[model samples]
Target: MRIFLGWTLFPVWSGWAVTGPKEVTAKQGSPLAVSCSYKPGYELYPKYWCRPGFLRFCFTYIAQTNGSEVTVTQGRVSIRDNHTSRSFMVTFSGVTTEDADWYSCGVKRRLWFNPQHSMEVMVSPGKAGARRWWRQWQRQHSRVCLCLCRLPGRGERSHHRAGIPGGVSLGELHVPARR
Candidate 1:
């Protein structure tokens, strides 16, 4: 049961102060991890790894760290903050297809504007090799690629960074379905 919301818990981009990999891939039954770094002054803000729904609303928080360097864990999800390195890490014990989605590494801010790093989490099922449709329009039946884009708001041009990230038109990660 997936929930869809209209509003976002955090906007896609505000200042681009945080940095992280645009995508993270993992195999089923294996662990996955991603790290995000922030500017020095933001060490006191809470850092989170969450799945965002349509309209960028954060639907679930897999893991989130306190405003300090302590580590937080919830079931299979874990998050660690390193204030000295100005970085935080989010990890999952056993990844499944349900974990694949558009996620963000963000800092909770006082104002509405929060610094967020967007990333796509891809979990490949029981297969050693995977194929993806890139830069072309190939119809996929099982699944479709979900990309995150921030539409231009007021004062921002309609063409400003409003397309797919990394400029890659990824269709889907496909593997042979079991009989």
Candidate 2:
């Protein structure tokens, strides 16, 4: 299993406040769950999951409901909003490479959609060959430390550090390849 953990900070001007990991990494054909916590003011607002469209502001909504809990089997996605907890969760079952994409957790308003948080879901092939290649690569570059940052609006940027103690090395990271 491969896991990618990072923080995705959102600017306060986004309207709604949400907190969750910046990215999620999972193996193909695996089950994965991600949760987003929202501000108390959005408790009664409908929550939704959506995929990014070609246009910057366009979104393809997967499923949404005003209820506290809703599930969609056709999409193999399930969502739950806990009013008492002030948070919502989305779960994906039997995820495939095709399922990898940028998704947003949003709150529906009267006239607009407020995206609280966004994430890039990456599904790895999970083949043994890939794992072996990663291991070999790590052994060859043991002294370098790499940090990947996902900047909003801008694309991803990586920073490399050398001879830093207690920093992440090559083998400790896993980035899924595009299919």
Whole-model lDDT values for every prediction: 0.72, 0.69
The digit string of per-residue lDDT tens for model 2 on 50-137 reads 7856533436667676754555443688888888887888888988889888888877767554656778999986676478778777
Q: What is the TM-score of each candidate against the true structure?
A: 0.61, 0.59
Q: Which ten residues in a row have the lowest lDDT in candidate 2?
A: 1-10
Candidate 2 Cα misplacement greater than 4 A, ranges: 1-12, 54-58, 70-74, 127-179
For candidate 1, give the lDDT.
Answer: 0.72
**Candidate 1 structure quality by residue, lDDT tens digits, 66-117:** 7988889999998998999999999899888888888888888777556778
- Give per-residue lDDT, candidate 1, residue 24: 90
